[model samples]
Target: MRPSLSAFKIRANMKPILITGYVNPDLDGTAGMIGYAEFLSKTGKNTVAGVIGEPHEEAKYILDRFNIPYPLLLANANDYDEIVLVDASDLNGLEGKIDPNKIIEIIDHRQAHETDKFPNAKAQIEMVGAAATLIAEKFIKNNLEISKNAAILIYGAIISNTLNFKGSVTTDRDKAAAEWLNKTARLPENFWQELFSAKSDLTGEKLAERIEGDFAWFVLGDKNVGIAQIEIIGADKLISERGEEIIKILDKIKDEMQLDYIFQNTIELLDCKNYLVANDEKTKKLLEKILDIHFVGISAVRPNLIMRKQIIPLLKVELEKN
Candidate 1:
């Protein structure tokens, strides 16, 4: 017996799967989405990479410098029947744009995530330094040749997210992925410095823009916490000159968002340390307890680099204890 018309209708109506990252995605998110979309397409799957918000300046720098094509800018994922998220697993990152029910797969590296919220997604939430590493592994394992554009993006993302492999979250896998991608990327020896320097420019209003653009907030236990991270070359100079401005921005955002605690983690690329800025006593005390550093005036110095993703789990555990 012949199959019914419904079988033909199902085949004809299937849409290309939409792949994207979080709202206002960083390099890791953008790279993962672009690379993974290419991987799927090369493997005989229909996929289209898209972005919900503007790509971060660092990501744009690599894209423009290497003349890589930008992913499709989408307002929402309503047009697609199935969606895949890369470097994003939380609903807050979606900003009420993409429906979690439509998500079919998730690839993220955050230790503290809301993967359970996306009940329909098959997730690969690892503890690597960057989500781009996971995407690179897919291509390597399948013996697929990654294009130069994807290689550069993914390589830069791994370097950026891992702070050039100096960050505490860096693993052997991230290093391996970067080594493999560089063969195709063929980036300059000083590419990491160039990448970091591109984002180090916080002149005029750019400082405020970078802080607000990279800020992330979470509800841990019963407290609303906000974390703003900046990876730059001159963290000390920025704090010394515009420390008051930083406090003002944090204060304004805290009041507007009604956050219980907030702080800025400034990772100084050259010095390989973190200058944590917090204006309030509560936030200062919390950092002192968890980070083992005392706040001098409005900021504290952490000798080693620690990204926001590494701090979230510590915050969650500490907050939940109180």
Candidate 2:
């Protein structure tokens, strides 16, 4: 049985804590902030879940489909005295909208991160499949009651981030969390297919929008690297038809962002493989060294699925060496 919401009241004389994620967050970030805020609130803390920029389409799909309320949209963290970041540890992802010194706590799952940037914050930077896994475990461990909306959000996030438990970064904790969350969310077994299909609509201008919306950049060693990840059902068909369009977008983004290297990693959900698109010789060489795939023309096919989170650490190790 779950406890009543009134059972846990916000303590007196306590300032509200704002929980948020990176700018233009994906499902993992969106779910983590919402779930963590509920966890803290249930523990008698005054916490509010907020979002800095627009959320990715995948996150939006869950919210709309499940009738889950959107988190408070925030332009910046100016109003909150204390901030907690979930599924976000990189300053670059924050896009200068959030002040690092004001952060109080950070919960994230990433191998390559910028946790050191938050000088005052205590961080839990683990390498789980999704930060949502950690947030779900908090509810399960504390034996606390979680709202249906939160459970649904976090469950969808776990499935999306782990690529339905097929991605390389998936762990036992993620699977366990998903199983527990399903008890509350009560979603169908085919929910993952529904969730993946929601984000697979990269038609016409949506192709450009999805690519740029999900793009992430990093400052590794002396070079700036930008990686755009697209998880679609028909990746082979998309790459075959719009390969030049993808290259054009990458080139434009690289020039606009002044990035040293850039590439697009298109993960085929149905096929469980990756189609990597890199335009330049430098980006191609870097990817060849890290992923060991020989590019024919502008793209290369990797037999197994490797997500951006898994690839970042490999890039860091190789780039830092040079």
Candidate 3:
């Protein structure tokens, strides 16, 4: 996504503090950035939410439905005077726009790594289910008023990240935050179902966008691997209907990006399971070795794998092995 240069204009004595989430931000990432930036603003901080890329389809739908504004689209994080990261801590998670030294604070709910690089930054990295849970707790604990829009965004994120608290990675904190936000947001009981349905409705170009936008790269033993995750319902139906098309796109991406390995996983949010795909035999062998799961055709059924947060780290460990 191109950065809006007009949004980057700086004024004297007003060193803008840019609050950004991880690259190709999902619902939780976008929501966490907005919520945390608003919290900082309440405390007299000159911070604005920045986005590394366009919001995901579901996220855009929610924001538009609720009339919440999108974060400032940023091509590079270095354009700001100071940076505060929300929902992601590692430099790899960022869009490679800023020096690591520019980060002054990090509020995340992911496993920490390479934190020593930011020796002076305030790092509050928790292993909660969703980063929005941490931001919601801050709002309540600090007695800060949450705008209706913020409440909707944060609440939706908690639900999305936690898979309505059914995913294996969900925690009590995520549920509690959702409960509190529920009281204020008063979202309809059907909201979660509707959101999941909307997310599952990807097709053709939308499906392609989802795959490409959500893709992430990792370095393992000098090999670059890519993982793209899709959170949807009725994953089996989608895979059966469009698996070939999806794999074709992923294959093209793998070659174009010169990735050593690439895989796409369809997370069935309703069933709390995963369907994995490897673009080639080499990656298939690696995945089989790494996951120890049998494959059917080009796909593997991992009924227990629910979160990329869990799968990515697991793959990294195995990839490092040899």
Candidate 4:
């Protein structure tokens, strides 16, 4: 999932914009999409947000909270001259939502290596925390108002996409952006406190569920290795309480799933003090002894907890090295 610009063969001249895909209607996905589209519109691009999939129920909460008008359901995608993709890490997943010939730019926080050859777009991927953080920045760059609801959505996006920044993908920019958005929009700690409480059923789900839900695998030589992300924000007290327990569970999942390699990163979402887990003692030792990192390497666990969007790209990076 490393960033690839092959899909974006930028044209010398461009046309109007039509932002599309990942209209999940979540704090991260929808807000980021809308925020970016708003930027295009302000620049006089014929911009619209398209959601190929159903919007998540939470989208309503965030949109209403921000009072930002949801983009109308596009009657057909071909009317727009160019398309900007947001939030979607996988472009192929956006089947039937757009005209293949019209894709022009992809501004996402994902690390998909497939840069489809399009002659009029760009791929702005910073395999870091939330895409919404980038979107928020774009809007702010345009002097757009940081409405209370947009703030909430961006904040939630920061939390969910980076797993509260516990994963390896989070950077100082992400934290700073989240902080800025929170201050401008007046976000409260109480909101995140409640959201973190919804545990991802760690009791006894299959190891495969934890691995599949949270991890993406890659073929590294003869061995198949995987990476998972867990973002824990400074604002959430619960992360400190249960992060280790979750790591142990993820370890069990790797063993049961017969994976040759496993890597886990437990990062402080608000900043970077990443905790880690690796299956191979040699790898763990190298990670700490040479890289000055620390982690617990073990086996057998359940399915719970995830930091998917960030984990997949990190997995890609490791695979290339392995």
* lDDT score for candidate 3 against the true structure: 0.83
Query: What global local distance difference test value does model 1 have?
Result: 0.94
Candidate 3, 104-153: lDDT as tens digits: 88888766355677666798888888898999999999988898888999
Which parts of model 1 are misplaced by more than 4 Å? 1-8, 11-13
lDDT (10s digit) by residue, model 1, range 122-177: 99999999999999999999999999999999999999999999998899999999
- State the lDDT at 10 in candidate 4: 47
Candidate 4 local lDDT, residue 199: 27
lDDT of each: 0.94, 0.92, 0.83, 0.58
Winner by lDDT: 1
Which whole-number lDDT from 0 to 100 does residue 310 have in model 3?
76
Q: What is the lDDT of candidate 4?
A: 0.58
TM-score of candidate 4 against the unseen true structure: 0.58
Q: How close is candidate 2 to the true structure, as a TM-score?
A: 0.95
Kindly list the per-residue Cα lDDT of model 2 for residues 241-305, writing each as its tens digit: 99999999999999999999999999999879999999999999999989999999999999999
Off by over 4 Å in 3: 1-13
Candidate rank order under lDDT: 1, 2, 3, 4
